[model samples]
Target: MSAVPGTVQTVGLFAGQHVLAELEGVDPALLDDEPFLRRTLAEVLDLAGATVCDVISKQFEPQGVTVLALLSESHASVHTYPERGALFVDVFTCGTRAKPERAVELLTEALRPTSAQVQTINRGEAEAPADGHREGAS
Candidate 1:
């Protein structure tokens, strides 16, 4: 059904948080920096108290980067588009232990995107994530 605004609603089966962001106008260099992205994602996840199992990243031939982390709670990832000076981030976690939304905020703060579109959702709930910021974020 529908989640009542201003009230916390219980999810059907999985009580999880999923944060998806679209960050635009980020530094192209930062977008292409696989090391920085990897380290930042790892550090933020850690700060969020997530148990990171492993992190894998790939630097594209011409540009761009993709960093994905396997978390004991779930998964977090970033896909960059250097040519467009943008990136897409996803932080999904099971249960209430990990602060997935905080992770996204950290990523956004670090990337310093000119425009950000971020969405947070309660998994198995019917309500769509409310728009926060421009479409560039999530």
Candidate 2:
């Protein structure tokens, strides 16, 4: 039974976690240092159990930096605003091998922001109801 062109095939269930953080009142110098930011991200991912594949970064004129790490589990990134002393950090990992939340936490620690806003998102299949209760059998 094989008769299809551009058909969708089931590939089991998928699950992943995404962690986002907004760090404020950080040191502008740290935010503009591309090399240090890249190294920090790589080390953070490793400590969070993520395998680093490749890293790419750019240093902006005036002041700013963006560092991205491609990971075996998924990927992680950081975008900085040196003028404002703030940065946005994101770490996402597929499957259960890595901890995205820990990555964010470690990032927060490394940056030492005056304040941090963090959010955790559960992605992929088999999510519970939004109201936090399973539907009764019908």
Candidate 3:
């Protein structure tokens, strides 16, 4: 049997997932606040259903704040550019325990951007051979 043209067959011990979101016309004031961003990250992680390990946030000299959340399944990060009124978010999880899209949605809602673009990619997908043969086949 053959798979459909648009379908994918995945076989792997781990599922590497990633979500990237680009937000435009966000509130610049919110982007510059370190405490707010930190808190927001925690909320986002919770929304994604991931186990939180540690969080580290830093504010730049002139402006902008970068927040990174270290999750037990993987990691989530956000970087803000206040001057351009834009922010970029990255969320990656190793297994099914986390939902990266939910995390992105939470961040977008908290930022309230005028326009947002989101992308989801399945990384490290392993597929079986097309010949229908296994390693132990005689």
lDDT of 3 by residue, 1-138 (tens): 328887877532366789999999998999899999999988888878988899999999799999999998889999999999999999998867688899899888888999999999998644435896656666
TM-score of 1: 0.79
Q: Write the per-residue lDDT of candidate 2 for residues 3-107, one digit (tens) a residue.
A: 577676643338899999999999999999999999999998999999999999999998899999999888999999999999999999987878999988988
Where does candidate 3 stray beyond 4 Å?
Answer: 1-12, 126-138
**Pairs in clash, predicted candidate 3:** none
* Number of clashes found in candidate 1: 8
lDDT, candidate 3, residue 36?
A: 97
Cα RMSD (Å) between model 1 and the true structure? Answer: 10.8
TM-score, one value per model: 0.79, 0.82, 0.81
> Which 10-residue window of candidate 2 scores lowest in summed lDDT?
1-10
Model 1 ranges with Cα > 4 A deviation: 1-13, 125-138
Q: Rate the local accuracy (lDDT) of all candidates.
A: 0.88, 0.90, 0.87
**In model 1, what is the error at residue 31, expressed in angstroms?**
0.5
Better of 1 and 2 by TM-score: 2
1-138 per-residue lDDT for model 1 (tens digits)? 448767876643356889999999999999999899999999999998788999999999999899999998899999999999999999999877789998988888999999999998888533344654534455
Model 3 RMSD in Å is 9.6
